[model samples]
Target: MNNVINWFEIYTSDFDRAKKFYTDVFKLELTDLPVSSDRHSQMKYATFPVGVNGIAGALVKMDEVKPGAGGTLVYFDSAEINDELSRVEAAGGRILRPKLNIGDFGFIALVEDSEGNLIGLHSMA
Candidate 1:
């Protein structure tokens, strides 16, 4: 089988807060999975679709795991990095770094979502 990232999970303290952050910023739909007796409150997760036919991930809550300022770097494709950067603030996210030209590689910007997750945005010139 070809090697590919099937999915990723972001561990957070509050599922509802994280869900709102992601949904507002990325325009993603988050659906909470019903709690089961076997799992109890041990497992809480929500899935996020990155793109059409693309890899997806989930938001999980683990009491043992503490949220960090930096953990993962998720890149999203954008046609207009500048415009997206503007939307970041309105979406309750902060721009860690403004869009910068990367020579032939295109443009990239670093941003922190409302939940404090650092993510990157990329656009091909």
Candidate 2:
């Protein structure tokens, strides 16, 4: 397989707040994604920049989706983990663990998003 993952969704309770947090932390604006069907009237989401290192993802909010920690953790690839970690707190996220070397694989850091989701940051540098 060229890539195992195609897209990902990060669930949030507060769409606006979560959008702002992600935009601020990543330094990129999220384009709103609309739901056309009434069955998903309560759903709202915004996608991250496409083709970002070939990973596509979105911040979603819906009734059935609950945002929290200790679930499936998604790791965001970074050129430098510190660059993103440095802005975590100011963007409303808490750094659970600072960047740590992972030998040949590279470095990784754990953090909690504004919505309380645990996210990992990875970098080769």
Candidate 3:
């Protein structure tokens, strides 16, 4: 197997809101697909194009799912975190923590999207 992460997903309760939030903040177009009969009695799921490549992940809703306090970390190819933070808020996301440094790795901040899913953004300046 190649040492690469092909895709990742964040289950959300509100598909439309999640799609809008990520699209606005990340500026990536999301394609939504109808769930199969085997999944949640036919709920909708969202697929997001990760970065510039063709890789993607499904954002689906599960009845047993709960809001994650902290888990997913997405790194944007940015030199500064403030700009992304601004975008996050403008895109209907709430900032959980301001930008902070983590040794020499870079800066990271936690935010909650419109669907109430918590995600982290990192920039290795």
Candidate 4:
């Protein structure tokens, strides 16, 4: 298995605000995707750029889907957790936990996104 997870979706209530929050925090672009499926015709989606060997995911907005915090935590790979942590609040997020060493697993931090979604940041630094 190349990866345990292939795709993921981060639900949002405010599409444009959420998009800007993510883009500002990560310093990367989220490419808007054209809806291709009838089942999801009403949902707006913008995907985080998938690296050559990384998983693909999108931020989604729809009436039925709601974003919440403290559920399943999704960890974003960080070059240095501090770099991203520094921008969390300014980008419309809250740092729930400061960076800490995780023994041999490196370091990790927890944060809440603009959409009230609990997300984790990880790095080996």
- Best candidate (score: lDDT): 4
Compose the digit string of candidate 1's lDDT tens values, residues 5-80.
Answer: 3345577877789889999998868877543323213656676765575655667674434466544446677777
lDDT of every model, 2 decimals: 0.66, 0.72, 0.60, 0.73
Worst 10 residues of 1 by lDDT: 34-43
Tell me the tens digit of each residue's lDDT in model 3 across 1-125.
Answer: 22133344576767678778888998888776544333323445576764566344656564534436543334344557788788987899998766755443355556788888766565655
Sort order, TM-score high to low: 2, 4, 1, 3
Q: Cα lDDT of model 3 overall?
A: 0.60
lDDT of 1: 0.66
Q: With candidate 1 superimposed using the best TM-score fit, by how many Å does residue 83's alpha carbon deviate from the native?
A: 47
lDDT of 2 by residue, 8-94 (tens): 668887889999999989899898866533442366768788785676667867554478764334777777989998899999999
- Could you tell me which 10 consecutive residues in candidate 2 have the lowest summed lDDT? 34-43
User: What value does the lDDT take at residue 57 in candidate 4?
Assistant: 68
Q: Tell me which residue pairs clash in candidate 2.
A: none
User: What CA RMSD would you report for each candidate?
Assistant: 14.3, 13.6, 13.7, 13.6
Instruction: State the weakest 10-residue window (summed lDDT) of model 4.
Output: 34-43
In TM-score terms, which candidate is top?
2
Please give the lDDT score at residue 46 for candidate 3. Answer: 70
How many residue pairs clash (N, CA or C atoms closer than 3 angstroms) in each of the candidate models, in the order given?
0, 0, 0, 0
lDDT of 1 at 118: 72
Off by over 4 Å in 1: 35-41, 69-125
**Which parts of model 2 are misplaced by more than 4 Å?**
70-125
